[model samples]
Target: MFGVLVVRLPEGRLGFLRAFSGMLAGRWDVEGYVPPLFDREARASLEPQGEATVKALFARAEAMRASPELLTLRAAHAEQSARHASEIVALRERHEVRRKQRHARRAELTEAASKSSTPEASAHAAELRDSLHALDQESRGDKAERRRLEATHASERSSLEPKLLRLERRLRALDRLRHMVSRAVMRRIHDTYVITNARGERRLLRSLYERAQPPSGAADCAAPKLLAYAQAHGLRPVALAEFWWGAPPPSGGRVTGAYYAACRDKCGPLLPFMLDGLFVARPRTFTPPSTTPGSLSILFEDRWLVVVAKPHGLLSVPGREASLSDSVLTRLKARYPDATGPLLVHRLDLDTSGLLVAALDARTHSALQRQFVHREVHKRYVAWVDGIVTGEQGRIDFPMRVDLDDRPRQIHDPIHGKPAVTEWRVIERRGDRTRVAFFPLTGRTHQLRVHAAHPLGLGAPIVGDRLYGRDGERLMLHAESLTLLHPGTGERVTFDSPVPF
Candidate 1:
């Protein structure tokens, strides 16, 4: 029976065995023994020892057969392993090829990016080169131009020196002459002439005077005597016939004819004058009495002061005019007969309608005056302007000044005006219009209106202000809220007016 067993040899033993087998196979003795074993049989007859030898030989054959089969299996396994290795190599080659392709693609992408950026870089480089070239050209040109200008300037200076000296002397003399003439009567006469000429009346006077001038010495002699002789003889009428003739001719017969003939002959060329009568009309003047009652309704009154709603078109105080017949102060005085020293604590423009505070007594007046002057009294205004304000809240810190020539007109003058400030926030927007809350930091006249119109660029001019806004309308600035400390109670007092816009 053929049997096979798998056994694990020790590490060094397997190699040692393999070497021993090789050495044995190389020996002549082993080769000779192999031939004898194969001689079949130095005959089959050698006792039971022959049977044993047969069994041993059979066992050896089986062992040899098993080794060759194992060798075959090992060789097949090795061949499979080699095929697997080859397949692994091919896969690796494919992987390498894919990796290289990926690398190549990455390189291509990098190159594309570089190319894309190159134009911009090249453009920047070109600009820099042009700028540098321009600078070099400019530098070269500037040197020549500067030298030419310097030479020209030097020549001009040399040529102008003597003329400048002469001009300076003449200017000084002229200045002295001007100073002298400024105080002279001739200068006054010249000024009067300039004034008359500017009025266009001087030409009329010149024409009349030229016509009145007599012919040389004839005025001193026979001309006067002849004019007197003619007057006596009724050749020239004593009543001045020109005056009697009036406008359009009078219906008279031969008398008119004889009068015309005598005047034309004696005063020969003395034409019958057609007189246009001049009558000057005098302007009627009237002193208007302060009879108009104040429109402002007094809501609250105390011993120290009165609080009232100021009506539009009423002045806070009396103005220097007969037309400005009645004002708030005058009406208040008339209303409160017993009150002494009625003083205005603050004032709103004549067109502005809002809450106003008046001082009844001198002590309260001084106190309130101090508060306003020191900017301790807080004022709030509500205004409606044109256009949407971009920011929610903003402060205008521009300075303002009144135009001296145009009275009451305020202008934004940063360099030479008083510091004025206003803080404002938009409350609501209706279409293109915006309602804003204003807090004036400094109380300058027309402060809020100017700031809103000028720097803020909100188009809505204060409604009634014809100077700064639409004309033939009432100003729309409303004193919405006012806060101040009471002089008597030492408590804070507040007043508010409803927005009129």
Candidate 2:
């Protein structure tokens, strides 16, 4: 019987050979027997007599030689697998950390959105959304790059493969989170606008409703609360108390019962109630003194010109309608009825006491008008404001524009306004007030008054100015000085008025 004999070597190196022989035997249906090895020499001595069996053994030995190379390949494969697993674990850890950070940032943004109410809040939300979007795009790009890398390494056993998968999953999660956060921010902005708009509309409706109602008993229904709320929300209040009481009281005297008696007759019933509790009563309606030709001290005079001191409350010229009576021009015309062609060269506010120049003919009027129009004539005024001025006389170059809502009032406009330049110097500081001499380079309505009050922070307006000055009936302001060149003779003339303050 032909038999496959396997010799056992003393070392365990023959274990794989033994297993292979068993497998071959099973396949070929040969009866395989194991023979014990005595020594290396004895094994070699039987090699010639057992050549056929030996040759079969040598073939099996040659197959066994390939096992070491297979084992090395297996070892390399295991090491590559472990490296890939480690990379996957690391990527997963990074993904978890990034997710947590994103969540925290979203919470912070939500909290900030709650406290902001201005339009700026909406702008901020929009910016945040843009930033989140950019991050999402970056994450997507990274994912694509990671996938590309994974594909390149797909054929090789790399530990980084699983980690790349985890990284891609984390990036997708982050993109979703960014989208959600952006949506939430936009929603908050919309909600804020809706709430503010609704509240504003409701307030407007309520105001109209209240104004339409009939006046009832005085329950102190003053909208003080509403006024405060409106002011806080940048709204102007409309329910202002209408007082019939005239201008504020003079600084030296208190309002007596007699003053209210006269006010009641002149202003009707509301006057007494308005003036009763106040520190000062309305000014007594007094008849102005007759202009007895020589009563006003004429500073300069000629056939073509007349310069004289103008008393407070007397108009420079008559107005086109009522509330403008007993003006200086009216008195001058009356006094000089035969003096033909008498014309007003310039005008001053009724309460501005100053040296006013008038032209006696059209020729002089045209000349003076040209001077003023060309700004060739320099004008100056002395005013007393309610604060101590520390600096030496200075110039305020702020531009000005008319306040349209408060007609006749001028306000500083740095942009989109006419250029106004006023030069001022402190003449004297008395108590808490300073007397300032002003030179207005450009002719503007209420130029000096607005510049001093707003830009210079001068508290008091012109002393006797009822509209612009403090809440006293007295006009503290006086046009104390004037300067100009003679329209005909070209001589420089200066006049000074007694300070009214």
Candidate 3:
């Protein structure tokens, strides 16, 4: 990435700081651009020595893997795992026998309680109920014990061996040593990456990432370098922008000189730390959805199925966190307390407002799910995109997968991604923004958003897509319509939701 920060010098002179990410031709300092955010000498010396040591450790480990001493150590580990397995098996068998006895005891108590009528018999039944409670405790204890044993077994497999049980111990030891050396080097390398926020508070690159080691090329981004230079030289930053001016990397597409946002994966966490105390107008401010409804809009309801209008910013289902408990699925469950199976037949993205269908019965859920799997269910989505589309209609076919580093954001990956297909038609031209309709034939997470933003697809991101494009009021994509066959009647039905944006 190439970055420029327009700055006002302390002497009232106008100038701009420029930087490029990472080293250029094995050098951090270029005559014209700003230097890297690191102690130059320390970084220069440490990298080479540390890398050599780590490589040596790997080579040693490889040689040790087939050594005689390593074999003996591996065998010892195997024996311990085997011993643990046998002990657990024996304990399980004993628990099984006790379980059978407990079952017989419960049966006896139940029968006695049912038959008792006299006062003396009733007292005896009460005593037997106490015994049943004790048995319940025993059952719970057995389950707990089983859980502990299973956990230990799993740990042994993970730490000692799993599929490679026959070649263990020494290999792990060597690997651990290599990790220790690498981490120590990384920590020292991290220390040299000294950066100061606008507040004049300096921090190491490692401090910014609390729970994680900084990803490769963390503080080496053009934006971070430019900001650091501006702060050190008593220059007040007026404006900042980054652009690409090189061949695109293998991971994603890029164009030379196209204005780009600071990378989410690399620069996202760092910018917050660097921009402290600056008059950052857009300093990644939170622009929450304009409205949050107290309830869902039901479009259709039958004995076997129900359809809902999912508002943008409302989750299709409740999230794992307690704070995210409100959702269409939760409301649906409350509305249909006796509903069976997984109520949702399909789900929409949290930012997508649309019509979603759900089943009230297991058979209906299965039938509807099968239709979706077979590509029989048709979906239409409408979105306001960032650029003018030349063609009226076209098909976008690509494979996509979640960008693991930056979650929820997907990238095109034909090798590892699931196949996604979307057909689109231009609805109208709205100056800089174009309103378009999308018909996705396959359901992949973020199918419409990625398809709309990808270079090979529209080459224009949806206007309000925060992940793939710039942030706006909310995502402009809406699930405009859905068509599917009714499981109850075996007849076609289509549902439409009002486009709020």
Best by lDDT: 3
Per-residue error (Å), model 2, residue 415: 3.3
- Model 2 lDDT vs. the true structure? 0.53
TM-scores of the candidates are 0.43, 0.43, 0.56
lDDT of 2 by residue, 128-246 (tens): 78767766765676577557656655757454445445544554565555455444433332222111121233221112223322122111111221222232344433222221122
Clash totals for all candidate models: 2, 14, 0
Give stretches of model 3 more than 4 Å off.
2-18, 23-32, 37-219, 223-290
lDDT of 3 by residue, 1-501 (tens): 788999999899889988988988787888999988889799889999999999999999988787776666678677977898798889989999999999999998888788888879867877987899999999999999999988887787686565354445557888999999999998889888887999999888887885758877899999999999889988999999987776544444444556667777778889998999988885453333557753588889989899888888888888877767778889989999999999999998778888899999999999999999999999999999999987999999989888766565688898998999999999999889899999999999988888887777887888777767766788899898999999999889999988987
- Residues 1-501, candidate 1: write the lDDT tens digits: 001111123332221000011123343123221111111232233324534544555555456445654456445555655665675566557656655665565566545555665648766556555655665565556456556655664564465455445544554565555445433422222222110111122221112223433222111122222222232222321222111121111111111111111222222322111111212134344332233433687766778878888876778888787677578888888887777665778887776668788888889988988888888889898877655777788888777787643456677666778988888888998887788888987888878777776633343454445555443345667888888888888889998777767
Residue 489 error, candidate 2, Å: 2.2
Model 1, 74: alpha-carbon shift in Å?
Answer: 99
| Residue pairs in candidate 3 whose N, alpha carbon or C atoms collide under 3 angstroms | none
TM-score of 1: 0.43
